[model samples]
Target: METTDFSQPIRQSAKGIIVIFAFNLVTFVKKFFVLFIAFGVSILRSKSIGNVTPTMMVLAVIGVLLIILIIAILKYLNFKFYLSKDDFHLATGIINKDNTIIPKSKIQNVYIKQNFLQQIINVVSVKIETAGDKKSEIEISALDKPTALLLKKKLFRKASSVSEELEQSESIEEPEVFFKVTPKRLLLEGLSQNHFKSFLLIFTFGFGLYSEFKDFLQELELEKHVEGLVELDEATILNLIITNVIILIGVVLISFLFSVVKTFIINFNLEVVEHQKTIEINKGLFNKVSLSLTPSRIQNLVITTNRVKQYFGLHTIAVKQAMVNVKQQKNFNIVALEKEQLDYLVNKLLSNYNDEQGDVAKPRPYFMRISALEMFLFGVVINGLSLAIFGIEMLWINAVFMPLAALYVYFAYKKAYYRISEDFVTIGSGVIDTTTNILEIHKIQSVKLKQTIFQRPRAIASLVISTASKSVTIPYISKSEAISIYNLLLYKVESQDRDWM
Candidate 1:
């Protein structure tokens, strides 16, 4: 009997047709959404159009969908993939067939995910990412859970001799899970989140949605009823305060609910598992996500916390990997972890994990000056808006908010510091939610120096240091100090023989 060879070409699941069809259909609609809306409005306004009734419009949409489905079928039929000992191969495209060959040594990560649609369809997606060319990432959109797992394991293992590989099938060891999020900790993390940011996000989104329905609400006379409830024109100072307090309370409640629900859906059952040479993250509720990462691939370990989170013994950790697509993917976060758990993970990932600090250096007072001016401008805009919209009765808001905002700026300035140690440089910023980013000197890829006209006169500059994963900026530092640090970082990078990846 002959052993089955993976080098032979294989097709993805037939249900890939459905996934491709759905993807293409959504893309098509999004591409022409505004045009379609405009056309529909014109059709409705015109009384002379004979063949453009609502039923006809629906049929037209159906015809477009059918055409998209045909294209998806052709694309799915043309797709083929295979694995060789040294490389992986993919053949795709309908009208123009593309053959892509990727080296096995260059494979960075493999992610398995199931979105809402895929969950309903009972299929999963496998994403194979390389260190370069994010556009070339390979995705198998529709595979059964078992097949996807088998494929992932096969792709992730080290190469072996033909006979040895054949005999050693199912050779991978089980991963040890070192960290998991508990329900109680998750709740505490949600409660300690920056709800002001959530409130702002909700306000921005709601304002945009309200703009779309502004005229409709006016037509229904709902705006007048709301105005009557508030009595903006004739209300006394006490009444005004009561209305504002009620509105503020309502917004606070909504923001709190949004943050808690969002946290649960995103981080439910989050766990970190370890293998011999890699780490795996499994998380998400409605949309399940599994990520595999190598220690050498990680570039940044960022930890964030506020006073409330500190009291709850919680921190949010974000892992930044080399060559990962930030725009296409969400940040890899391990939420609601303790200090000890974080230290273990950091030491495991980063070999030179030193928590010692030499000297905490601050940017010159010019940074404070800039921040104050910016805050002043913000105050002007906010107070101006309040005065214009709500009359002089709202002028007291600045007396209440400005002092608190100024104190926040002062705290942020006090928090901003950079400490360079033997092998790492720590950058700290933020007041309400303090975020610390640790960067290794050996991994520094490039260093940039910049100076504005105002900064140059004062011998001040901004130092921008970039690693394989991300960049960090140290602004409003002395020009000579920035240059000295820049030179030191470059020298360390050159002296080290370590691979940044």
Candidate 2:
């Protein structure tokens, strides 16, 4: 088990201070330019005469620039950051001083970044993100590399100390190994997925290229002077078809090459390493990327297997965790793993489930039927009349509402086909793109039970579980089933101390 001490203050080096000042100075100049130009434009447009005197405009611009410069200087002076035994403090604001404190325990993630300019200056940017508020994250930009590293270590120690103080049962042991795609595995999986998607991509690319370049190709006028006597009557049309096909082929080949190159480059130099309580992945080619995640931070787990992978007895699984302020959910993927490996991974992560747990789930039998009265009223009274008013030529297509009406019945049947256990809910649906969404009880945030008159007679209801990006919906389930799941989710959310997303 790993242990850390939290009672330490953060400090920056002399180089860090200079680099920060330089960065702020550049930012200040840029802001000044924008403000000065905006003021100048306003003054010019609001002049008494159609054209304002150049002298007044120049002086006005200078005055605005001077104010901006002064503000920038004051802002730089006002900004300050300090770390204490159990919290971090930041204060800023030129005219009105503002101070904010973030407890060590509240820090969700600390971001470290460096750009080309920052590298030259031997500085890095550190952003402290929290789970409490969306816009309240604090940033300490352009600090010396050593200072940034020190800050990161300090935060890590603080978090570790807190975990220890909380007396959590789980010992903070270092991970055995960070899982990464081996070169052979990467090649195999990349090629497999590439081949699977290639046909669709080729067709789409070829068609789009033809559509875009048709006029240009035709405008070349080379076809008119063709010497070949392939066809006399339908020569022009044949030539057009041939030209389009050639362009399509070229486009497909080029797209395929591009995909291959991109895949290789992206998966190049991939590395994964785990320290106590944290898994870090560093990868990418030109624009290197790094992702750090902790198991306690996980919000949801998603495992997906494409038809090809399934056919080949392989599976790809991803574990997702919520990251504050980050647009994308942070995910770790295990690609092309065999059934045994996948099972081992899953068992390790969710140790609460037994081997026979998945099979023990039973399908809820309450059936919900869509209200016939509501459907009839909507079809004839609402949609039917609207189409008539709009002068739809093929009104019979609308008049025959079996296709849409059939959906109601099938969805109900599909919902009946699935089952839910105490620990997890499994929803199975879709015909061509068959999918099963398995959500753990602990991952559910808020449960919403929705029903309309259209659904009352059908006895069908929809349950939406609030997640990080979008709510997961289990639709056309029996009212009983919906309520059962809803209650279960509610109990889990209330009982668990972890925040949902």
What are the per-residue Cα lDDT tens digits for candidate 1 across 380-463? 899899899789899899888788878877987888988887788889888788999988888888899989998877999988
**TM-score winner:** 1
User: Which prediction has the highest lDDT against the true structure?
Assistant: 1
| Candidate 2 error regions (>4 Å) | 1-79, 92-98, 114-124, 143-150, 160-176, 187-218, 221-242, 249-268, 310-318, 330-349, 353-419, 426-438, 468-470, 492-501
lDDT of 2 by residue, 4-72 (tens): 222343334334545555555677668688875776677667753456676776776577656655665
Give the range where candidate 2 is weakest over 10 consecutive residues by summed lDDT.
Answer: 1-10
Root-mean-square deviation of Cα positions for candidate 2 versus the true structure, in angstroms: 8.5
Report per-prediction Cα RMSD to one decimal.
4.4, 8.5
Global lDDT of each candidate: 0.82, 0.60
Q: In candidate 1, list every pair of residues with a backbone clash.
A: none
